[model samples]
Target: MTTESGAGARVNCVVDAEGRVALELPAPVAATRPHLLLRLRPKKGEPVTVSRTVPLEAVADGPARAVLEPLPALEEGRWDAFLLNGPDDTAPERLRPGLRDLRALVDGHLRDRPSPVAVRIPYVTKEGYLAVRAWLRTAHAEAGRIDVGDRSTTVTARLHGATFEDGAVVRLRMRGSDAPERDVRPVTDGDHLGFRFTVDHEDLAAGTAAEGGIWDVFVHPAAGAPPIRVARLLDDVADRKASFVHPAARAAGAVLRPYYTLDNDLSIRVATG
Candidate 1:
């Protein structure tokens, strides 16, 4: 098949219920050596990359098609997709997003997967490139419906890859501080295995002086299970810090607000009045 050399090419992506990814290139790629390259967005440390070749039959007259199976999991991060038309030495072409089909992901089909729940969401980046937000969690506390009250905030969350024991508790620990941690037992409903906990704004304000601080939230699923971070990752929203804002409550001359961090982990910020 013929291929395009321009960097302005685009890719249409469709993610199945089982986390399988299908990619369609704007133009046909080399049938012999077409590949999909996923490079994790760089940070302070070294970035990770994964590559998968396209099968012969998946390509046809129209756009070149390639499928990335769910197995051999990807690292948890935002990965940018590229189209490699030639050998490994070929310059990869950045792919713009087009016609993304992610209905299965919206239906929450992978939520019941086994331990180390793997989730991959394909989306268009702010730069208009095709990228994926991935997560691999051994134990996850997915923050669900939240109710903000005058004096307290109630959070209901679902536990995955871990079961709640009799002494299950949620911990609120101050970030970058030595302050003692506060623990509150969540009322677990056996029917759905979901739990809900309430955080008092006054209690959070009392934990810190006038300056106030940020408290990271965690869930202790059982007696021996390691603490799992409370986050919201089951949906399509890649970054929730700015998109998912919550109303702040005033108590003890302080403003208490719950918000999602840059990493999408749930945290409460207390600011002195």
Candidate 2:
């Protein structure tokens, strides 16, 4: 909660592709016993907790490193992160243990403290859990940028560290409760991929909107390639306030817009006139 980088202990953390949490510590802690504590509390389900003794691997007595294997993928919801000095009578500080629910977080939110030097962010997983992911100082896919309008919708994205095979195809797949999956291939452009899909006015009517007009976006590569979710990475969601989201409502005409959720996934809002 403190904005100070090393207010208590200066540490750096990251989440790897395999879903493990890795921690790096400064010089002083190499001699003292170190412990890693992780707590996951979902919005609607039981909480999860994991603890491990961090083997102090010395690097010139300066920076130390440790890795904690991944916990089971959580049920969909929001989760908070804490890198506490686990229970040790010999250590200087012992952070309180146990996970906290959303109400606990809201009622007892960290306040009046220096802005937290946010080492981790609360994220939402594909399955719908609000969660936290390990930080990686590497380039990855950024799918937060999207364009939605009454006539059509467009998406432009690039996959970092990913290469496309020749003759591979990219597509935008959308579905609603009332409509079947609409798979449209996006036009490939210079370096990034671009997709433009038309929306019929009739599909925007208020009656049709109520049946589930909101749409989620996903990247569909070639037939054999695993579909990549077009999601916002880190802190790159620029259109949080303006994007249209939520199911469509009855109105005079159809209004289409895009929106980003707290978990950083993109959804479309359809309002029919």
Candidate 3:
């Protein structure tokens, strides 16, 4: 896949979410099926095998390399890649109606974001309150309350149960400042379906926290209040917010917010909302 983003090559592409996520290999794919496969690893967990195959029907204008689309609020790094059929394939330049249709499908995915962004607010501690503004330096497992606005779970659980050791195949990597990448995988859904994904964050342990800085994760869902965690990192120095999430091995998630302050009082405060 080519880097240095430009209008990359266009090929029929399909990205799977929670539902009927399937890909059928094109005739060309008959020979390169293995390389086309991507093994997505969740945070400290075993990698989940995405076995679907998407055959390139109509090739369109795209880059020489697969690119992680440059969107307004997309996390900096994650799994955003697609490989070309040939090393020096120039199919994107000479586009046709068939290829044009393929380009539209891929572009649609980039333009449509199906994820959440972080919105943090902080305040000084009050009589019974521990000041909400300090979530900036807090961890998701420790910081606070989170409410997903009553949205029902999208991915099924029975499909994504833990079938392997945590972190063995899965992976968790921070992409952008506002939020990191959280991914999960399960063995099978209750109905015997193959698998599913849930949002979750990789434990940014204290040892890994930047110098003079303490990193924490939270579940503050209000977008106006400190998060409340029901599950948390192994050693949450901050707090927890169970009301917002149901901890599942296949759940994936990320965090985004403003700046934070570590004060002389040994207390922390975050930037404005």
| Descending-TM-score candidate ranking | 1, 2, 3
Each candidate: what lDDT?
A: 0.79, 0.43, 0.24
Using Cα atoms with residue i matched to residue i, what is each candidate's TM-score against the true structure? 0.89, 0.51, 0.22
Candidates sorted by lDDT, best first: 1, 2, 3
Return whichever of 2 and 3 wins on TM-score.
2
Please identify model 2 stretches exceeding 4 Å from their true place. Answer: 1-32, 49-79, 83-141, 148-150, 160-179, 190-212, 234-252
Task: Summarize candidate 3's per-residue lDDT along 98-181 as a digit string, tens digits.
Answer: 121122222221221222321111111222221111111221221122222122122311111112222321123333365443
Off by over 4 Å in 1: 1-7, 30-32, 45-60, 109-111
lDDT of 1 by residue, 219-239 (tens): 987765689999988766677
* Candidate that would win on TM-score: 1
**Pairs in clash, predicted candidate 1:** none
lDDT of 1: 0.79
